[model samples]
Each structure stands twice: as C-alpha cells, then as structure tokens.
Target: MESVALNPATLSGPVWVVAPHPDDEALGCGALLAALVAQGTEVWALLLTDGGFSHPGSRTYPRVRLAALRLEEWRRGLQVLGISPERSAALGLPDGALAAVPPEQVTAAVRRAFQLAPPALVLLPWQRDPHPDHRAAWEPVRAAWNTPVLGYSVWLTGRGAAADWPVAAEAQVLTFDVTPHRRTKAAAIAAHRSQLGLIQDDPSGFTLSAEMVDRALTGPELYFRPYGQSVD
Candidate 1:
C-alpha cells in the first residue's frame, strides 16, 4: 500500500483535531499536531467526552472529580502541542457512551465548536478505529463540518478487525513521520497522568498499556482521507 508522506507545511491554518476522550488526540495524532503547530498552523482541539468513565471504580476520584482532572490533563497536553486553552473546547458529553447521545445534539455541539475558527482541515478518529466512542464520533463530526478530514488511527493498529481498515477505494492513505517531533509527542502523551496509571483505586479502570503507548510513540502515524476530499 503506497502512501503519500504528509508535510505539515502544506496544510492550511485553523485545523481542528477532534478527540472522543481526553487522551485520544495525543495517542492518535499528537505527532502530527505537534508538527502542524511547529509549522505555524492554527490548531484547535475539540474534546467530545468528559473522560470520567475511565476511572469508574475509583473511590478516590469520583466521576465529577475525574472528569475535571482529565479536562485539565487534556489542556496541559494541548499546551505541550502549542495550543492555548482558549483554542480548545470540551463538549462534556458522556464518555464510552457517545453512541447513546442524540445525533443532532452531538452534531450541534461539534458545529458550535467549529464556528469560532472554522477548520481548513479536521483530524478525527478513524471510522472503524475499534473503539465504540471512536467509531461513533465519525458521523457527527462530518455532519458538523463538511470539509477535508484525515482520520487518525488510535486502536486500529492494535485492536481492529481486518475489515476495519480502509480499502483502496475508500480512502487515500497518508502517513506522517513522527521522528522529528517524537519528543514533543511523547510529552503530550505523558501529560495525561490518569491514563498512565495515576489512578490506583480502580481495579478495572482504564490505563494505557506500555505496548499501546510505545506503538503511539513509534513513527509514521496513519491517516485516511476519504475519497473525493483534498486536504490542501
């Protein structure tokens, strides 16, 4: 499968990166985001969920407290990527249950977020990224902004089924080498402490495995551009 190497400089300004949870952006598109910011692209982040569901079983951090902490972590990570807090918006939707939300409602929130600085390009989770929230996020974002989008992979590499990957006819494959911004990407990923095992009370709470983190930090992030869309 031949893929074009992504050059951040070619992208237009006011690019928006949408994440279903706090850490999805860092895990999926951190390197590319760093690259875009370094090249002086105007970047905005939109978080779809409260991110409190990860530590559901933790007594030390209740849902509200966990959500607040995760929001802070998200902003901190964005800061590392050169995005100011003023450029980010969190929808506060339910984590792990995006599919349950009304489609119009979700669409409305996403549209609202994009109004301030309409996106020239959008980076969103792959439609078949293997996480329910990731998959559910696809439509509303598309509905909100009918512009060029690069679908970044989060769980696709690790947990996706064979059919989940984009076929030749479905998308134009693109890859961005993370080598130059590896350190920046890693720092952004590291800012999410709760996802990195900071919450010890929830026995079944979500924590990014070392393997997942390593895979994310590895070079060449995958992006799928749907057919008929031009990123430029």
Candidate 2:
C-alpha cells in the first residue's frame, strides 16, 4: 500500500488544523477549534503557505510585500480567535505558486509541523477546492500521515456537491453544526483586509457585513474522519 502521512485517532482528541490561507482556518474549522477550546482541548493552527497573490491583478501589492501584509492579516485573525503564537505556525511557501513547490518540500514542512504538535486529530480543506493552493496544502499533510486527519471545507464555498469532495482517503468525519460559532467565525475573517478583494473586490472596507452572510447561508462547518471504522 502507498504510505499515507497522517495516522487515525479518536473523534475527540487534541487537534491541529492546517490551512492554505489566513481566512480558511475560520471558514473551514472555526467552530471545531472554538468547541475544542471550550472543552480545554489544546489546538494548534498550521498555515501551510503564505497567501501573497490573492488579488492577482494588484500591481501595488506584489509578492514580497503581499506576503508581509498577509502575515499581519494572519496574526490579527489569530488574535481574534485567541490562538497563541506558540500554538500556531506559518509556513511561507511562495504565494500562488503551490503547484510549483516540489512535493518533498511541502512534505518536509508537514513533517516539521507534526514533530512539533503530533496531533491526534488533524483538520484540512478537502481536495475539491478549485484553488491549486488550497489543494496544494493537502499533499504534504497527507503524506506525513502517522495520525488521523479530519478534512474541513472551505472551497465548497458552501454551495457545491457535498459528497465525494477531493478530500483524502483517510477523511472520515464529515460536517459539524455551526450554530453560534458562525458569527464568531465571520468576525474573525473580517480581520483580513488585504485579501478581501479576492472575495469580491468590493473595497468597501473590511467588516463582517459581507462574509457574515456566507457563513450562515452557504455552509456551517464540515469535517472528514480518515481512519478506523469510520469509513463507509
């Protein structure tokens, strides 16, 4: 059998979430993290790659500068979620160039992250995401599989086919109720002012007004458990 990176674990376990971008953490697993925090379970947020080129046509904010700007966005978002710097890591792979990065390079990053956290449960964006970067975030994490991985949703943007997403084979847990956490997640996403243009190019300023609706109407939170008897 081809070796997978993550291992399987119980549903309720110390968790680590891997995100392709800054806001995806909230869009994909905000509630899950909030729920875990409420339960006093340790949680870590792993940002797989830097998101520097979100607004593809923006001449003012080129790669290097954009990376720095996005890092600030990440820090602000983490602060809103109360995720400590000690518990989170940002892997600065080239922005908009996930496809260009070698698989080994990405896997090495995952290995280093796992060595630091060794989480019993992992959260990730499913494979179905249209963005190459979102999908790119999955590879190394999947290759480092000594533990169980729980795939989360973001690219579905809450409006696509809910089944057979490009998620990894190990993904078993699917979907979790959002409830009150929905608003909290939206508030956190609003922290990323630089990247809002990617969403709609509104330039109307960063606020919860736009993203808040996406969280409630389109999707709540989704997860996939990739291990044990969980698979159907």
Candidate 3:
C-alpha cells in the first residue's frame, strides 16, 4: 500500500488515543504520540481494559493486583510520551472479555471518558485489527464521539488477514517515521514490565518477544483515516 508521510505538525489536538490494553498504545503509536507532544499538541489517553487477563494463572499477581500494576504501567508509558496521568482515564473493563460486553455499555463508558477531555482527533485500533478486544473497541469509540479518527495498527502487521486491512477506497493510508523517536518509543514500550517478562510464575502468561519489540521499533507507524466521514 502506498502511504503518504504524516507530519505531526499538521495534526490537530487534543488527541485522544483509545487503547484496548495497557501496552497497545505504546506498541502501536508511541512515536506518533511523542511527536505530537513535541509539537506542543495536547495528547490524552483512554485505556479500555483493566489488563488483568494476561497472567490469569499467576497466584503472586492475582487479577486485582495485576490490574492495578498494569494501570500504573500504562500511566508511566503515557508520561514517557508526554501525556500526564491526569489526561488519561481507564474504564476498568474486563480484559479479554470485551467482545462479550454489551456495546451500549462500552459506548457509555467511552462517552464518560470523553467528557473528561474532549478530543479534536481520536486514535483507536483499526476496526478490523486481529485481536478480538481491539476489533471490538472500534464502534464504541466512534459512537462516543463523532470526531475525526485515525486507526492505528497494533497486531495488524503480524496477525492481520487480507480482509483486516483497510482498502484504498475505505481509508487514506498515512505513515509516520519512528526513526527519530525510536529511543523514546522503546522506553514507553518497556514501561510495561509485566508484559515484558516481569511475571515469572505463569508459564502460559503473555510476554512480548524480542522480535515483536524489534518490529515495532523499526517500522513506520501507520494510521488509517476512513474515507467519506464528516467530523463535527
């Protein structure tokens, strides 16, 4: 897909990034977030899940404790991207179960978060992102605030099917180079210690592989702006 280079200075703010999980924002759009911040744009974050499901089998870090730690890690990552903790909100929704939640309920929660800091532009996972939670998060965020949205890619490169990608007629593909902000993006991703081998007890627990981290740091971050959308 041919993509135009995205210049952060051209984007308006305050921008709100809606992440389905704690590390998603960092993994997906950390460099863009950092660039926006450096451009003096106000960036806000809305985390959708409690992020406790990743290590469900660990007794040392139960769901409740794991959730709290993940929340803290999220805030730390946002801070690294120059977004203050006060500018972020977490819905505390159950991780890995968003698909089962009623859409109206999720939309209502997303609306409440928007009330805190109304966004000029919103960033969310692509509507057809590979992960179930990421895919499920799309509509509620769009319904909550009828604003301009740029869908960021999380698991798209590694896991997305052909249908998962936005077609040329559907979206304007844009890419932001991360080379300048590689270190900052890396640090933001590293803030999620639990997802990066901090949890030892659960053998089945999730841990970001070196290959995944390297992939994230090396490429240009892609954003898709849906065609034929009017932003009020």
Top candidate when judged by TM-score against the true structure: 1
Q: Ten-residue segment with the worst summed lDDT in candidate 1?
A: 1-10
lDDT of model number 2: 0.67
22-92 in candidate 2: lDDT tens per residue? 77787677766766676667788888777776665556666677778878788777767667778888888
lDDT of 1 by residue, 133-219 (tens): 999999988999878999999999999888999988999888999888899999999999999989999989999999999999885
Cα-based TM-score, every candidate: 0.98, 0.79, 0.97
Candidate 1 similarity to native, TM-score: 0.98
Mind giving the per-residue lDDT tens digits that candidate 3 earns over 33-137? 999999899899999999999999999999999999999999999999899989999999999999889999999999999988788999999999899999899
Q: Which stretches of candidate 3 lie over 4 Å from their true place?
A: 230-232
TM-score of 3: 0.97
RMSD of 3: 1.3
**Each candidate: how many clashes?**
0, 24, 0
In candidate 3 the C-alpha lDDT for residue 152 amounts to 95
Clashes of 2: 24
Off by over 4 Å in 2: 1-13, 157-173, 197-213, 216-218, 227-232
lDDT values of the candidates?
A: 0.93, 0.67, 0.92
